[model samples]
Target: MTIQILSLRKKDLDKIIEIENESFVNSWTINDYINEMTHNPFAYYLKLIDKDSQEIMGFVGFYIMFEHAEISKIAIAKKYRGYKLSKLLLTDVIKRISLANCENITLEVRVSNIVAINLYQKLGFEIINTRKKYYPDGEDAYLMNKNLREED
Candidate 1:
């Protein structure tokens, strides 16, 4: 199973939205993706593409403004779960932002997502704050950060 992580293109929107809707209860629509891809200069999007099937298995999105990079969303296909694909997607995103000279990367995860929390922590992100009821379903979120500029 070869998965290629590539910079996302407009043609991938339908596939990206497919995975997004499958993973999240509230997913971004195709139009939303189009608007972001076309209009947002700071936005970075990447996809995990299955080489054989030519399918998009997952995607990660973030926005870099000034010295900060905020991970907007990430999700893998339902059939692709338990394969550690999301971690690969996010890790690549972080690497790309760091190579582009971004100083900070941040994301907000649902407080109940212990798996994601552990993954982020293992990748060197630290919790900086929390937002009460940040999700539409009243789920709380932990605001996390990984500083690219300072190793220690």
Candidate 2:
């Protein structure tokens, strides 16, 4: 299947919310997405689409300020997991951020999410610190960072 990565748009939000709800325990509301799209000057988001079927398979969102960027969310649809699509999406995001002259990127992941932690590590992210009870459920989170400047 042919896939395309494009900037997130208003038309994609419904499918994004669906995937977000399926993937995260505390999903952002539609209003939250709208505010990010409309009001947040630093926020950036991208959607992965099945070009043939016009279906959104996944999305990634982040914010950039100065030389630093922070990943806010990423999710692939339940049916589309295990195909390395998350890797595809994340690698693209990193490349784009690097091109924008970002020095580093940071993201917080649930400490128990081994699969995600492994993926982040494979992408050159390192666990730099931990946040106690970072999640709404009181789960600890690992603060991971990828230094794009070092990669250059």
Candidate 3:
């Protein structure tokens, strides 16, 4: 399947929410996403679309503040897992953000999400800290970070 990464649009919110609901135990409300997309000046969101059918397969959202960027969310549709969609989406965003002079990129992943943790490590992220009971379900989260200024 051909995949194309593009800036997230208002039109993609419904599909994005569907994926978010299926993938997360505590999904974000529509207004939360709407506020991020429409009102948050620091936020940057992107969507991965199937080039053939124009279906949104996944999305990544982050906030860039000067030299630092924090990834807020990244999710793939339940049916689209196991295809490395999240990696593709994240790598693209990292590149885009780095180009914008972001030197530090960070994200928090559930402590139980081994797959995501592995992916993040493979892409040069290192676990720096942990947020105790970070999730609504009282699950811990590993805070991972990658320094864009580091040697390739």
Candidate 4:
């Protein structure tokens, strides 16, 4: 299946919410997403859609501050697992940020999320620190970082 990456639109919120619910137990509310799209200057959200099925396969959201980008959320549909969708999203995000002249990129992933942690590592992010009970449900988080200078 061919996947298309596009800037997220207002109409894609419900499908994105479905993917978010399927991917995370601690999902963001619809209003949180709506607010991010409107109020956040640093934010850029991308939706991955299957060209044939025409359904949203996944999404990646991030924000760019002065000289850095912070990954906010990434989730793929449960049925669409085992593909390199996350890699594509991350690489796309990194590439976009570089073009925008960002210096660093970071994200916090639950320490127990080995799959995601591994993916981030493979994408050049290094563990910088850990946050205790970061999740509302008390799960700890690992703060990962990647500097664009290293990509040079």
Instruction: Compute the lDDT for candidate 1.
Output: 0.88
Who is ahead in lDDT, 2 or 3?
2
lDDT of 4 by residue, 71-146 (tens): 9999889998779898998899899989888889999999999999999999999999999999999999999999
Which stretches of candidate 2 lie above 4 Å from their native place?
A: none
Candidate 3, residue 79: lDDT: 88
Best by lDDT: 2
lDDT of each: 0.88, 0.94, 0.90, 0.92
- Model 1 scores a TM of 0.92
Q: Where does candidate 3 clash, by residue pair?
A: none
* Per-residue accuracy of model 1 over 1-152 as CA lDDT, tens digit each: 88899888988887887788778877899889889989999997888898999898888889999888999988888998878888888888888889878899999999998988988998999999999999999999999999999952
* Cα error, candidate 2, residue 138 (Å): 0.7
lDDT of 2 at 4: 96
Over 1-152, each residue of candidate 2 has an lDDT whose tens digit, in order, gives 99899999897888889999999999898899999999999999999999999899999999999899999898889999999999999999999899999999999999999989999999999999999999999999999999998777
TM-score-sorted candidate list, best first = 2, 4, 3, 1
Which 10 consecutive positions of candidate 3 have the poorest summed lDDT?
A: 143-152
Question: Where does candidate 1 have its weakest 10-residue lDDT segment?
Answer: 17-26
Q: How many clashing pairs per prediction, in order?
A: 0, 0, 0, 0
Task: Name the TM-score of candidate 4.
Answer: 0.96
lDDT over C-alpha atoms for residue 61 of model 4: 96
Per-prediction TM-score to the true structure, in the order listed: 0.92, 0.97, 0.95, 0.96
Error of 2 at 43 (Å): 0.5
